[model samples]
Target: MLKDKMKEVMQYNSILNQPNAQGRYKNYKCFHCKQMGHIAKFYPMDYKKEVSDMKKDTKVQGFKASKSTELITYPKIIHFSTTCMIKDTDLTNWDKIWYISDQINRHVCYKLDNFYNIKEGFSVTKLKNQKKFLFTYELGEVLIEESGKSIMILGMYYAPEVTLNILSLDLLEKQGFETKYDGNRCTLSLIFKDKEVHTFDEDRMKKMHNKYLQDYFESLSK
Candidate 1:
């Protein structure tokens, strides 16, 4: 039933592609911002390191900080990303990008590199904080408590047939999401007025979800 409804919605979205389409889409509001033509939490990017970053040794430009030796559990790479999508809005602007990028570098990836031996050259590249970076970890006994909150950061099992990256889970959880997993399958959905911080994921989402769980947990431990 839901798939059929989705099909109808897609058809309506296609109409916007017409030569002279305009105005708010009927029954086609974005789930993310509750606007038109998008969803509330749409994240489609490679959460792992990009190949271009590792392709060559470009001069160390951008933000620089002292390298440190620390014991940190880094976000496990399950897959890489190529592209992402966002609704057309003024809210999605350069300022947010720069801010997010800075956070990712200073708080998430760079710190993790200090503790764990992440991919080569990851330590040197300037990390950018995208919404996606915060959530990506392997599921283990590790739990990171941040903002005075206790939560587990988990990761995906590396398999022979699949690649993974981070996406919407972090944002969803921030909005109070409830997720569950059986070590292999992760099912995620919004929890309305709920208090439990336990998040869930399955299939491909599980790998990324676990990574997030790991990252969050490690951050708290530090």
Candidate 2:
């Protein structure tokens, strides 16, 4: 029974993977630049271009259109998700009918709720503080144990790319690990538990996992 239920849940993609349901939600616009097709980061100049440009441009491929995408000012390649609810009849029907009452009784379907993904990169077990890797496409969480401290993180919240790389470099430096980042690719060499560690890094994958680790470290620093 449990396996069957799990199989049923695995059928749908996470909200990030699903097509944006064309209801009332529109494309994202930059509040700073008043541009359409992108959020604030998409526009560089006004918000101290340094901070904006410092950001690595990670683009998500194959996203369907929304209201904000239709606007002329927004960048076409950038993606944005709506936060505030719009007062649309159709949207109202969805919220009132499906999300509220129906969802409680019947199987509810929403982008965020459909899938589970524990972290951005490939899940691993018994690495550093990580004890296990559990993932479902839509939502993901991580379990950490160190110095008798154990934590289970639940949700998509994670680190930015730059922060992750910086943190990873910092850790590697401490352990006398050698690493190189050629713009997009990052290589790390380390010695772990008397074993010579050698890794040919995937910049994209490293960034993905780094974001999570960086975010975790930042929270601790804070």
Candidate 3:
């Protein structure tokens, strides 16, 4: 009886170790190329070709002059009065903390001073009047604690040229948050998550924008 029981256990272990009819131990799909049998981490990426293709596509689109005189609707801004602390260090001198709904920006951007020990080697080119400049920067992440709640800002670019940090509308939407603009005020709420967050009224929003504009013009003069 003991010999028969041992033989059955060995047979079960052998069957469990054997591959399925398709003959694959495990199936893996590449997230980037979307091909099977391999993962994204080990896949050889062609960065140069990707960047070249992107530039070519942009050039193909070209530029078209707008002929319409109709006024375009701009997104309302939300202002925060709380201080932005980076890793237990209070940024007392840095006061401008506001978010404007911008559909064009793909990533969240912050001033270089807001982060600590950023990892470098990334650059972006911005074109103005056919002139392009290399905007080099490092990437950093920060925890924004506001109104008794905290949100982690991932993949934030440390841009030195920008006067104020901007939270991208695309990023917010991608994170399952929705924004509703009612001309004078904007509300940001999460779709599936229930949490209390900070918001600004119309009057305070206007004040924040005015203060930023004043500081911007003053900086230009100097």
Candidate 4:
């Protein structure tokens, strides 16, 4: 039985700061300007803006444009399936990105594998410490596209130690959304579904996620 239901509903918790470098990954935060050391999808300024070119198209909605997100795993029993590569991007392959966070205050988005369909319990995350291993992940919903508009993340969290993919501006301000900021760009306007939203600037953060170190995004773009 799915390995006895994965040993009675999974449970993994043990991460007392394991980043290893760059000042322990600058304590990871950057859900954009909410800053700490940097990670706002690889923050870096002087980005002249230009991603509206998706020319060689590739295959986004079905994923393959690349940066990470091939989903569908099963690390424990469930017949031991495979294929999991988070470190995702849904702002469209401008360059791969999906990291916006208010420190994931209990999920409004969080993905690693399973893609989207998880449910019936599972979610336990942390990067600097906050040990929480309830069901250990399996709640879902993820369909962000931005620019072409589609935002529909209703509660994802299949976090397998999340490599990249976190969008929780304080749990999207508790579901009613309405966040605004201009300089470094950040916009999430109210009640979507028709109103739509997306304004991450820096030319959509230069097409998303670069993975720090361009002189640390040019010393925070000065």
For lDDT, the strongest prediction is: 3
Estimate TM-scores for all models: 0.18, 0.15, 0.38, 0.22
* Between candidates 3 and 4, the lDDT winner: 3
Model 1 over residues 199-222: C-alpha lDDT tens digits? 655667988888999999999999
What is the descending TM-score order? 3, 4, 1, 2
lDDT of 3 by residue, 15-131 (tens): 344445124523766565464544444444343356468876763312222364764253222222222222212333453354544533543354544553356657865545335
Candidate 4, residues 115-201: lDDT per residue as tens digits? 534454644443335343323455566765544554667776655444455566767778877656544445555656475566657
Stretches of candidate 2 off by over 4 Å are: 1-168, 181-184, 192-222
**Cα error, candidate 4, residue 123 (Å):** 4.3
Predictions in order: lDDT: 0.35, 0.33, 0.51, 0.47
The 10-residue segment of model 2 with minimum total lDDT is 97-106
C-alpha lDDT (0 to 100) for residue 121 of candidate 1? 32
Clashing pairs in 3: none
Q: Each candidate: how many clashes?
A: 45, 17, 0, 5
